[model samples]
Target: MGSNSHPAALYQLRIVTRILALVILLLVLVGFLLPTEYRVERSVSINAPLDVVSENMLSGQNLSQWMHVQGGRVESFDGVLQNDDSIRLLYDESDEIGELTLLEHTGNIIRFDVRPKLSTGLVHNRITLEDHASVTEVKWTIEGDLSVGLLSPYLAFFANDIAGQNFEVSLLNLKQQIESQN
Candidate 1:
């Protein structure tokens, strides 16, 4: 007679399958709840010194020149440095109208926090400068988190490549500006 080995064997299999499914469900749930942080960085060496390039880019006036609003702009002046020593900017790039705060500036490093029109979160800009005998090395980094809806984390997997490319372009522009001066 053909017979199953035992009911206990079938019960164990069912338990294992259920446990595996539950683990997968938990992983998916966790993924959806967590927001994704994205970072893009690019670096180039310029013919000038680090301090010189840092001065131009970190200053409010120079920041405005290189940092374009996604769309366009409003008439402006050199940004006023506040009591906290942070530079403030008011401009419209496309639909985004907001301020970019220059947070910190050392000899060769500058930090920025930006408030954009569409979303809520900090966009961090960091510039690092290295002094070389011939040319100065400049590293620019943009790191931020995009708050997600239920489906955003899933889509982020696809969006990261494009986001990285955009970061490259931003760094390229900064590099061009610094190099052009020489």
Candidate 2:
């Protein structure tokens, strides 16, 4: 009876080991198949005019008021926020921490190519304003590739939710700032 019980226990252990091995293999395969690029977008409606929202966004001032950035000031910029204009920002009074180049600045749309000093990937940020009768719809989008080779897929899986939450908070701040000013 003892010998039979020992064989049964060994067989159960083997089965459990095989199941764990298959699960690990499946996870690895899924990781390899996941997309490397990720995009995070968030939007809010502001009770302001399109021109007013555009002015606030293009000025690059009041960024710290709405975003998580602190001690932000425009280091260099074209007078009119045209394409190819470069703006440098410093965080927490540290050295210039990030660079943003204007990719497009047209009616109701502003786009920037952002490069953060701490990151290896390029971030594309676009802010679009759609005019409604009494409110303007503001959409903020950030798109980039993880660029971490094999670990990119795992990182991207959570990128949207994490980044999206940040965007949402910033947008809410922007809305509050604009509404308070009006």
Candidate 3:
């Protein structure tokens, strides 16, 4: 009777602590097994010529007209929207923006490599225009790797829907801008 209560209480506390440790270990194992990268692609057909679409797409000055970018400013730019041109952009005065480099430029395809200032990952943005009779088929793709390790898979899971909506909206705006002018 002198020590019966103390032994029982100690045993109960050990059981609770072991259960919590096991739960945490399972969660960590799941996180490590999840994927960490994603690619988002969205496309739309525009009732405009390829040249018209290409010009508007390549011009940095027209970014605000069709894209919902917040506090975006072109810090520096070189060349004339052609291959090898590099543009430094700052958004919301945050160090999260990236540098856009034109990796490929052609009559029907344009590829850009984006290097973020605060992240170790790179983003590949590609725009392709195909002539379909009178309508131009525009395909926009953005692929990137998430560098946040265990938490990246959770982010990638929703990246497509969120980013896809933005892409669709921007494409609709671009289509309207080009068609209205023609």
Q: TM-score winner between 1 and 2, please give it.
A: 2
- Model 3 agreement with the true structure over 1-182: per-residue lDDT tens digits: 96999999999999999999999898778777777778999999999878878877767656546754435644533325778877775777676776778899899998987775536567788988999877899998999878686678778778899779878988898888888888
Q: Which residue pairs collide in model 3, if any? A: none
lDDT of 1 by residue, 1-182 (tens): 23566677889999999999999899789787766766666777778777677667655555556655544432245754432454333444354455666677778777777665435667787878889976788787877766656555655554457556655655566668877877
Pairs of colliding residues, candidate 2: none
- TM-scores for every predicted model: 0.64, 0.76, 0.77
The prediction achieving the highest TM-score against the true structure is: 3
lDDT of 3: 0.78
What TM-score does structure 3 among the candidates reach? 0.77
Error of 1 at 173 (Å): 2.8
Candidate 3: minimum summed lDDT over ten consecutive residues — where? 70-79
Worst 10 residues of 1 by lDDT: 80-89
Measured by lDDT, the strongest candidate is 2
Q: Where does candidate 3 stray beyond 4 Å?
A: 1-24, 70-79, 93-96
Tens digit per residue, CA lDDT, model 2, 55-85: 7766555554576433453453334566997
Q: Residue 102 deviation, candidate 3, in Å? A: 0.8
